[model samples]
Target: MKSSFVFLCISATLAVLTITSAAPGRGNANATIPANRTQNGTVTCAGLNDQKKALEGFIAAFVAILFFGSNFVPVKKIDTGDGVFFQWIMCMGIWLCALVTQLVLSFHPNNNNNLNQTVPVPFEPEALLGGFLWATGNMFCVPVIKCLGLGLGMLIWGTVNCLGGWASGRFGLFGVEASLPGNEAENFSGVALCLLGVIMFVFVKSEGKKTKSNETDDERAHLLFSKKIQAETESTTLKDMSKASDDLDDSWVDRLNPKVKKIVGTVMAIAAGLLFGVSFDPVTHLEQSNCHNPQNGLDYAFSHFCGILLTSTSYLIIYCFIKKNKPQVIGEAILPGLLVGVMWAIAYGAWFIANANLTQTISYPIVATAPGLVSALWGIFIFAEIRGVKNLVFFSFACALIIGGSVLTALSKS
Candidate 1:
């Protein structure tokens, strides 16, 4: 089933790519040029460029949403341990994708000057700040998941992420220029609906089995007993030692008081959402500010990814030091981590394109909230994590709001 799904995804992606490549006005430099201005001071692109840009932006956003929603599926069943090691491995994959992107941009015909020689894209150090912000937020995932569970944690962070990202672009926060959509009322309403939908997701309980950390003491003990009986031929002392080691490896979040854990998880979720919201600020700043020549969003991808890799490595080193050089590392998680990273990189790259073609105000809410719908679908159909009539009803309602919100947001830009 997984193989079939993978094949379907690949085929769909290829089909989209073929269609996009053949689309009218794509890659036409003149398409984006301001050909005229109306009496109201609104700028308009030439001919079909405006329509084409909108199409491209929506397509890129769809791809981003799909990839972001499914990126973690590979590692869903794998033991990621503390996640720091897994994140570092994933960063490696992200960096590899960035390297490939850099190479492609270098060899692209557009990079050639009047002399017909390729001009290498300059690395923008400012973009590295975005990477640092993203990696720092990612460091909180395991704790948040342990403390709040995946559903609630995602609900809080995803809502904040949608609102924060939309507001940043809409209000010009953190030195980015404000990007107002053509239809202010529609845009604001869309964002509000999207946030509402995301908030509603918290009420949809998933029936997936609890993790070891969430399991009751009796349940854990019974599981341990079963394991002991299965390995009865082995030494009892060794088994006791192994269990002790496992207990020692447990997350500190698991040991926290319930009330304290809730507070910490909520705080972490908010912080992560804030960080994720502003993670693209540096790139936006570079494009808007005169401090540096304006560049395409893709040009900054390598620098941003490099920052992620560097920050993740630094965090991993600190984590190892804190764990006395015995940080939790699951060997089985390495490949899945890399795969997740690669998928994230591709999704983020598409996000960059979407942002460039359709202002962040128009794209942020859709990208941030639509993924929840996709993920919920995955849970309902593939994972069977979400079940029961009540959950399904809530999921359907949330999907309606999100899809409606996205349409309105897109139309606002148009």
Candidate 2:
């Protein structure tokens, strides 16, 4: 009975995400690939670069959506198994294997040349702190799933995660503490307002001054004619674009209008955390079922492998394309990703072990709420994702509603 209501709430929350930017390509965050500007009015069949990129996008999104959507079901299915250790080991192993493969391939092509070496930057304490908050939050998520069921955990963590994200957008980091209490009734009201503010930011379109497209062509012809007279072998386009990529270097990362960045990043992160919170449920269920056939325990390992593979592969593909200098970023991302992965693995693995020893209704909530509250504090003080004085008041109001709702929901379980 408790599970059903929790599931219902989660479903409602997911519906909201789907309606508001969850489905993809509906907002600015998803870079708009203009269809009308395609070559010959059709997607030109290009070499591997463009084709690979296009296919990768589709595959990555497909895997991600599937991975997130099925998390609850898998956890539920595996509720009866003693195989938690094996399942988790294989899942983490799968991701590690993938990472190893990337490293091997990167260095294998040029054993002597250091062309692909990463530029070392001093470890920034702020980035590490941000990563720690994420790792800790992820560690807490597993029990949250078990206890709060899917919906309420999503609500609590999702909101707090948003606060962390907003901080990242504003201050380029996520662990500051907000002075406001999250448990006041007024805090709940902020949820609706926050949602509205997010929609406004995401959906609002801005136009840059339009320019004539052909002006460049005429200029190009004149330059080419001049080049021919000078007997130069090069085209001017090559010269103009030689220093193009670094053009944005002059701008500060915080140049993104701090207030707007804070709001948008917070909203995006919150939505992402909410979606991610619900993503692992399916795998949890699959492991719990222990419905291993005559084929053996390989079924459990294989199924778990499938889920992790989908997630890790999808992430790699997406990050590779979206962050063009991915080779450089790989060093930065891997350690953090591992930290997050292990934290997440421990949380979910522990939940499975506990579920095996105790009833689903009793053990899950305890673990879930522990991180629920901890993450809130981390977001406020550590990440400082919350905004102004008014936001502090709003945060307090939302926190109250969240606490009241959580209490009421928990009490209703009896």
Candidate 3:
């Protein structure tokens, strides 16, 4: 027990360090934005805008890290004893409340029937995949937390998730495991090795441009000469090319190439997975912390409300900043956010019930591994991410390590 407490302390310290180290770098990343804005009072408007952007990035990253990191600190306070049912009730209430708030805020009071105007939902494949993956991940994690304990479960889960994220980006499953034995530590090791393999597979540069996948030496020479020749020939072609670029930028998904598109998809998948993995810990924490008082339901309620609001709102804000001049984009953002909110509430709620029927050590590893398998399968079949004999060999070794890690972690009595 004392050792467990010590481990927890170390984990907490590490979490803090990760956040601290990342924050300032993100802030400085926006330094160039200040040069473009107009001046105001004493401060340059550009500088102010840059500062705001930096601050927003910090807040977004901080909340994201908190959401992801919360898994280690299970809600040991407010169990409510009703298990999954309680989780359901809480989630349902939160969803309803959020929906109502969204409706109210989105509506304009002065115009006739304006407030009642329905939001037109887009055909968003990414949102669909995200919600489904997240829901599945949540269901799986209850079992993992039961088996693995909060700290180690989250660690391996996070580690595998990181690799799964990379695979989903380049050419792997969305968030599923491709193939590995049911062992947790080995599974994670597999994911790590797979990550290494992927690193070997792709040639990345500091600017994210140069790659081993480029044309041969002669082809490069020809391309460079052609570019110079084209530049000398006509300014009109340059203008036309710039116009074409603008048009491509207008469509939301057009900006994404296969590689970037996969990354975006994978990011959405992992966001859902992370949510699923951490779902039960908060409930468990709440149960342990607030079992003595009935009215303290508000504590758990407020915390979850904050969680949902933080995630959805940050997503909206970030999207707006990324795609400036498209304020109407918020209309399209509604459904996906709403879908995620609903799915999130339900997944977490259901797992809380599942936890009542099992031990955390038994439950968590299974949960963590399920989406991993799903992601791997998606990579192989749906996305056709893996190929060639050498790649396959590397993939197999990675799978073995992932399984070994999972087994070690799950069987840990510590």
Candidate 4:
């Protein structure tokens, strides 16, 4: 019963993303789809929706927010490798879904019978590069999780991701043009609220490193040993402990300095978010770039996922040699990785649809806020990574900020 409801919810969420943004071309972030404009400023597609469509779109947005927010839940249960091997599995699932989508789209004709092509055809180079950019950011995920935990890590990066994706479209960063359908103040104010939320989240300590503090403590093992065993094991454990400390001291990334680890994780998280934000730059280029060869949606999806496959494979191969040809492989972790891959593939697939249907200015902020909500819930209830009355209060405040920002952003479209 529970599983069925979850599946139903997922379907409904995908429906919202597909229905709300599916018509694309032009849209306000409110519960409605606006008419799409052509390059020459003429209304090319009407995109007017009945109440039924509007309602469905609203419901689907609700579902999408939850699903996108919680899609990474599976990864929390299992132990993954240094991220390369696990990332490969996730990318494989993304590609699998994209391949299926492409095959399905091949049956449909995007152009008239004369052109004989699907929608968004021509397979632009920039579109493929966009996927690679996203994959590069994803490569740092595991290390960030290990150090920062999901709640804090996702919050920090999610903010940056939202800002980057939204800003590029809002202000036309990187030569991509803005396609916002509403007043500028409405959109920018929403962005400000979102930024305020991110700032609030940053001050909330995650109690993350404490989880590892005991594991690294030399006397932890001594406490587990019996009285007589403690006496004998003390010498052995102390020696082993010294060796363990030495081992930690050897690696630059995994060094014994907590401050350094925190800094590395934070930097990686920032980079990951920035990369993810730019992942859709090619799609924007297709719409706005002068040299762009607009391809069909199917080809775009295929090329994007292909980038994920190609880039992830290269990263995994590089990591294999770095690990001295003995890469860590956990058979048990594969299932979890696959699960996240499938879920993320679906969510991301919807993302493309949403992007096509609505500009990044309207969609990215709402989509980005979800994972933090879901992950923070997991962190608090499932993992106990977040604790203390003070932090909980901050968590509540953060949630309010996110909700307020999202609502204002949506209203900006109206």
Give Cα-based local distance difference scores for all models. 0.81, 0.35, 0.38, 0.67
Q: How many clashes (backbone N, Cα, C below 3 Å) per candidate?
A: 0, 54, 77, 11
- Tens-digit lDDT track for model 3 on 1-414? 356446544553453333222222110222244354445546566666545533433343233323232332223222222122233333344456434433432331321234445332112222233333333454334334444333334444455555444233223233322222245454445444433433332221111122275765456655876786577556557777676446334334334576665455445444545654444344334333333322111123224444544444444455457656343332322333333334333333323222322223323443334333333444455345455566556555545544554445334322
Cα TM-score per model: 0.87, 0.32, 0.33, 0.74
Task: Arrange candidates by lDDT, descending.
Answer: 1, 4, 3, 2
RMSD of 2: 26.3
What TM-score number comes out for model 4? Answer: 0.74
Report the lDDT tens digits of candidate 4 across residue range 1-414.
Answer: 358436744664464345323432221233333555656875443344433333443444555566676666766645574667888988887787677666655544543434455443344566788889999999877778766776578766777898899988787888778676466787777777777776777666665424355552235544554454555555677778666445324234564378878988899999999999989887677755543343223347777888889999999899888867867677977766665666676667666655554567877787777556666787788667789998898888878887887778776665
Better of 2 and 4 by TM-score: 4
Clashes of 2: 54
Off by over 4 Å in 1: 1-31, 36-47, 111-117, 209-243, 291-294
* Better model by lDDT: candidate 2 vs candidate 4: 4
Q: Which parts of model 2 have CA positions greater than 4 angstroms off? A: 1-306, 314-330, 350-373, 383-388
Q: Which one is best on TM-score?
A: 1
Question: lDDT value for candidate 2?
Answer: 0.35
Off by over 4 Å in 3: 1-157, 160-282, 293-306, 314-347, 350-366, 400-414
Pairs in steric clash, model 1: none
